[model samples]
Target: MKTLLVFEYRRGKLTEANLELFSFAAALGAQTAGVLIGAETLLPAYPGKLYLGDIVKCKDYNPEVHADIIMQAAQKEDPDYIVFIHSSYGWDLAPRVAARLKAAQVSEITGVSEGKFETGCCNGKMRRLVRPATTKAVLTIQEGAFCFTGEAEGTPAVEKLEPSADGAGLEFAGYEEPEKREVDLAKAEVIVSAGRGIGKKENVPAIAELAKSLKGELGASRPVVDAGWVDHNRQVGATGQIVSPKLYVACGISGAIQHLTGMRNSEFIVAVNKDKEAPISEVADVMVIADVMPFVAALTEKLKQ
Candidate 1:
């Protein structure tokens, strides 16, 4: 099988998610090639062939033009699968390329089982494994689902192509920066996340205290955020931020698959929950079965002392 990875470059660098794409491609046991519509300097030491479209000519993001560049690369590579990182960019561009190529399109793919792609369904409460009925397919992988650890064997062979930028109805405008977030959970070395098991919003501070004692940031599961116990920016789950802290303490979290997918890559995990069979226990390095408030209070006191 041959897989083509569509790399996204932003802020003068390749997005970190591209590493996960390499890891995904490696799992497929296929010949892999990459394409980027950006500066050559932004290219990584990919192990496979790389197709570069100069950013100067292509300019800023225009969905139609970028899709055409990817199409040109696809024509050259003739890959069975064209893969993207499931981000805002992929959400917009993947379908367009798929439509042009007349290929199957799958989004938010979390895993591969027996040569089939695994994705969430029914609002992430269940998983469904799917195989494309078409000869070619477009895929967008869920962020943080795959970890890249392997090193590139050698420099990739570079092929330069000039794709047309004309005929796009959309005009290019200067990029606008998103509003600064109060907290960037992705950079936290340690994260203490609260779940619905905390009982009530009033008890949220106790969890925050535990996180403070650990010198870490406070994170929340989707339910806690939805219930207005925590801000949306602090949420840690499939619908929230994907984090891989050095240490993660999941409090009252029952380990829903959506929640686990976000923090399962933590170097070490400790889950405090009353239920021994909570799904979080499967990925946790230490599972503490105790009342949420008491356990958090005790741990905070111990850490402070």
Candidate 2:
């Protein structure tokens, strides 16, 4: 099988999601080529063919122009699958390209099972494997689902494509910065996350103390955030921030798949919950089967010493 990866560039640098595409392609055992609708100078080092469309005429993120450029590359590559990262750029451009090509489109694929793509359904409460009915398909991969550890080998053979720059009624507007947040969990080296099993709001401070003693940031599961025990900024789950801390301490978390999707990539996980069979234990390096409150208190006190 052959795959065409549509890479995105922003703010003068290429997004890291481009590397993850290679990992996904390797998992699928497919031959790969890529397209970048940005400056040729920003072209990544790849082992395969790369189609570059200069950003000057294309203008940063004109969906119509970007899709046109991708379509041109796809025509030459004739890939079975055209893949994109599930981000604001992909969410807009992938559909436009898919509609033009009349290909099947899948979004936010988390895994591959037996040559089928696995995507979350019903707000991530369930998972379903899918195969496109059409011979050609468009796909978007969820960020952080695939980790790329390998280094690039061999220089990519570069091909330049001319962009038509027909924006199709849409005007190119200046980019706006996202609203600033109180915390950026993605940068945290260590995170101690509270779950519903942490009990009442009063017990949250103990968990915070544990995090502070460990010199880590405080994180919370959806339930803890929903209950107002913590701010939404500290939420670590599908509906919140995705984090891959060096050390993650999940306290009293039952480990819903939604929650796991956010932090399962942590380098080392330590979970403290009363239930040994809790889903969180599956991903944890250390699963402490104990009550949440007393265990947290003891651990915090010991850390202080």
Q: Which candidate leads the pack in TM-score? A: 1
lDDT of 2 by residue, 1-305 (tens): 99999988977889887899999998889999999988876677787899999876787768898998999999999999999998878878999999999988998898987667999665454678899888899999988778899986677889999986589688788877645669999999999999999889999999999999989999999988988999989999866888999999999998876698799999999999998778787689999999999999999989988
The models' CA-based lDDT, in order, is 0.87, 0.88
Clashing pairs in 1: 255-280
lDDT of 2: 0.88
Tens digit per residue, CA lDDT, model 1, 1-305: 99999998875778888888889988898789999888876677776789988766775677788898999999999999999998878989999999999989988998987668999765454688999989999999988778888875567789998877573688768677655678899999999999999999999999998999989999999999999999988989876888999999999998876788799999999999998877787799999999989989988999989
What C-alpha lDDT, on a 0 to 100 scale, does residue 191 get in candidate 2?
Answer: 99
Please report the TM-score between candidate 2 and the true structure. 0.75
Tally clashes: model 1: 1
